[model samples]
Target: MAPSIQSLSMIHDSQECIKPIPAFSCCYLLRSCVRHASLYIGSTPDPARRLAQHNGDRYGAAKRTLRENLRPWEMVAIVSGFTSRVAALQFEWAWQNTKVSRHADLDGNATQELGVRICPRTAKEVKRVAKPRTSLTNILANLHLLLRSPYFSKWPIEVRFFSADVHRVWQVWLQRVDGLLNDGIRVVTDFAPDGISEVEGKELLAGAGRVGTLDVGYNSIKEYVEKSQFLLEDGERINCGVCKQRLILQHDIIAVCSHSSCHCAAHLSCLSSHFLKDKDSDSELVPREGTCPTCYSKLEWLTMMKEISLRLRGQAEVNRLFGRRQRAGTPKGQGLKSVRGRGHSEDENESDALQVSTGLDTVNLPPCSDGPWTIDCAIGVLGGIAHRPGGVSSGNDSDATVTPEIETHPQRCRRNQNTRTQRLGLQKSAMINLSDWYDAEVIE
Candidate 1:
């Protein structure tokens, strides 16, 4: 329409001062959030206007987009602030072809840093390892991005993370969540390392049209870092069909198509993009119509999604909750002392309580632990063994008596000593007999 526009496109004249219109600029991703999960990318002057065109409001919509008949599309992301329409288009081109751009200003790292994702048609990886948002560096970077947005000035966003409760967050159960709140879609966001269902969940929840503000980040798994690994054998081979990387981890989303003849296995996200590309059905409602890349077998999305979800639910769930951890039991060979531990009785010593509980009241307890009422020590003092004049006799002092004349008479003394010794020996013999009798009675 203008001389400058014409010169930029067709005119041979290269003028330094002549600039194209800088007002037109925007790049967007049109993605099916819920069922189809198709992604389309392009640049436009007005996103809303271009969206209407894509929907066939003006002319026929894109053949690929309309072929799938899933209506009510939502703009997933829009990147603006380019200097001109040409710049925006170039950006789109860069996004679509990361290695093809010949422009001097464009770089692969820059494009990648801007969140321009490339879904490979072939394999080189198992799963796309996403960084955790809880990392300090990532948290600060996300914070910077959040602070840059103008929406936060008016309506603030709050992120709340819940610790893993072994039952819900870590285990796979078939029980259905009975009721859902009618007001808004309450999503369980487990953003862990890989974002919860990636971008699909966020877009779905946002498009729910709830009146109140919504938190789009992963809601279920941020509070904990489940440092777990694969439960499979080392001999088993697993690789992502898209990235071609080894799918060695349990956390990896491995999706396998069971077509009997063509059992094609791939990472879930990798197969998702492939599913869209290989889809034969023109209707989006007729899901799971894609062909397996390896076997050409028809891929049913419902079956694939079900299998993937079930596996992902099972993968490392038990490990996250009840996997190998240090046992809470007391260490081996070391005796358990209950009194020192918390909430123990302050009135009695723990050792005393232990001895009492084990049926080893006073006699069996070692020295420095004997109770004040122990019969062995009390009887020792009363029998003159502990209070002996010269020194305490090592044994048989319970019957011997001290007298002025009794010590002079050797025969009398010997008889008294023998009697004392006999009496002490009898007492010990009687004690053993009584114990045996009690044991025999109990056995009977």
Candidate 2:
């Protein structure tokens, strides 16, 4: 027979019924900030002892909570399954410093690294911290390196690929994977056969704690190649792709490879020279369009150059390939297409592009807005400023002048930037509940 409710409760809540916990490890979140479940992330091996440490009758509370004067913090989340203490420490560090960590999502989304966004209504979302702009080629190179890093396998994280549109993000990544396999890019580069390392497995992607990367490939070339992969706009970097030498001069009409699957930018004229040098078969009908030295995609000179001339000539092409904002009257799945049909050959130029266009059309792009201010980075210049060094409020106020040198610290500059952004009050909208990233599905 089932035990009575009173008897069951008594046994379950008894001290003897509690299981023993390990020592020397584990990070837990203490939810004490709210009246119900306040949130604070921390790590300790012995949760029982840690709880006692936070609210001990003797000794003192941790410095983080000493100011709050809140007692009896309850442990709500416990992260386990780390092989070593260093790994746990690494996780704690990333969680605390989410903005700088590669594992954190700073997409101006209302998500938290800890998996649960704090108080749904009261939590102040953090704004994105800016970094210097970089060339897409350089960025992709670095991303490729990190993807193959041993840390990607050992560390607990997820790598999410984003496009301007979420559905397209998945499509672009899959296409990249296929291109690498079918085009033999895997033979030259360190890309894995399946595209992910085996050892890292689930921990690397590690569920909701995914690290987001971009399909920054298509969007960031020097010039936008609209409507036609046939024609390319002027690119920023041009070295002899074959010799890796600087082009003799600036006005070289480069002959770039015309493979839509691979946008390998090279000195076009240099490529033709290399093709002829290789003793590749040459004729008027089938000119030597030798393989691209970089991506190894087969190239035919006639198709590479001819396909382009037939496609574009100085077009704005805005709102052409870009997904549109979804309107209320639109039908569901109205703009979807298969990735296979989307791949157009030189023969199917206009028609194939039309098919690709269907899937590319999106309804609503996430709105552009400001990010939440990082409070730690907030400038406290006016708070009790009278006694700060060099500030002579106590002396003659009229004679005081604060030079720019006073705010030279990199840390202070960050604080000032954050403060300035906070004063501006620009912010984006949310796709899902920041409160529970694990359970919430963001559909827009």
Highest lDDT: give the candidate number.
1
lDDT of each residue in 129-200, candidate 1, tens digit only: 333221112222232232233322111112212111111311111122122222111213222233555454
User: How many angstroms is residue 74 displaced in model 1 relative to the true structure, after the best TM-score fit?
Assistant: 1.7
State in Å the error of residue 73, model 1: 2.4
Candidate 2 structure quality by residue, lDDT tens digits, 187-295: 1111213555433322232221121121211233223234233334443444666767654323333456555555555555567766766655453222334788877
Report the Cα lDDT for residue 91, model 2.
61
Model 2, global lDDT: 0.36
lDDT of 1: 0.37
Cα error of candidate 1 at position 222, Å: 45
Off by over 4 Å in 1: 1-20, 34-36, 103-444
Best by TM-score: 1
